[model samples]
Target: MTEPLRWFTSSHSNNGGQCVEVADAQDHILVRDSKDPHGPALAFPASAFAAFIDGIKTGELR
Candidate 1:
């Protein structure tokens, strides 16, 4: 059965610009632009999402 995604914004978001919303689904994490809630979302595997977060902490994303 499919479940509805509960989306949330980052705590750091201050409504300045270029924000994003995230939601955890059954298997993967969902990412979407805050500017367009009805727009497309990018799904990343759990491990990949962890790695992406690690990259940001280590400055590898830059």
Candidate 2:
């Protein structure tokens, strides 16, 4: 059986309704808008997601 998603938002989120929730799947990282829990989610490979986060931290994504 596949593992269930355990979604959570950033600890720094201020509940401003513009946040996103993330979950770790077996082989992918899932992301979705906090305001739309039942809506569709986007999936990214784990390595790609890590790279994205790194870019954000380094201001390369801005």
Candidate 3:
């Protein structure tokens, strides 16, 4: 049997109707548009995903 996908969203996501959802499992991280839950999802390495989050927190991605 196939494992079900577990999804998560940013804690900072507001009720303003704009947000992104993420899913982390195994060695990869999955990102997708919250507005289109059944649409495409992008997969990234756990380390790369962590770095991206760190960059966002450090104001290097803004």
Candidate 4:
């Protein structure tokens, strides 16, 4: 049987109205809007997700 996906957000997220939720399981990484927990999620490859985060941290992409 396939395991259900688990979601988590950054602990620092509480400070801001903007928050993101991520699910790390299966072959792809899942990202969704925390404001709408039941909304459709976007899936990306693990590497792609990592690069996206790196870009954000380095201010290469926003």
TM-score winner: 2
Task: Kindly list the per-residue Cα lDDT of model 2 for residues 3-54, writing each as its tens digit.
Answer: 6789999888887878999999877999999899999999999999999999
Per-residue CA lDDT of candidate 1, range 20-39, in tens?
89899867999999889999
Per-model tally of clashing residue pairs: 0, 0, 0, 0
Question: How many collisions between residues are there in candidate 3?
Answer: 0
Kindly report which residue stretches of model 3 are placed more than 4 angstroms away from their true locations once superposed: none
Clashing pairs in model 1, backbone N/Cα/C closer than 3 A: none
- TM-score for each candidate, following the candidate numbering: 0.82, 0.86, 0.83, 0.77
Residue-wise C-alpha lDDT for candidate 3, range 38-61, written one tens digit per residue: 999999999999999899999999
lDDT of 3 at 57: 94
What TM-score does structure 4 among the candidates reach?
0.77
Off by over 4 Å in 2: 1-3
Better candidate by TM-score, 1 or 4: 1
The whole-model lDDT of each prediction reads 0.89, 0.93, 0.87, 0.87
lDDT by residue for model 4 (1-62), tens: 88888888987678464688999977799999888988999999999988988999999997
Locate the minimum summed-lDDT window of 10 residues in model 4. 10-19
Q: Output the number of the lDDT-best candidate.
A: 2
Better lDDT candidate (2, 4):
2
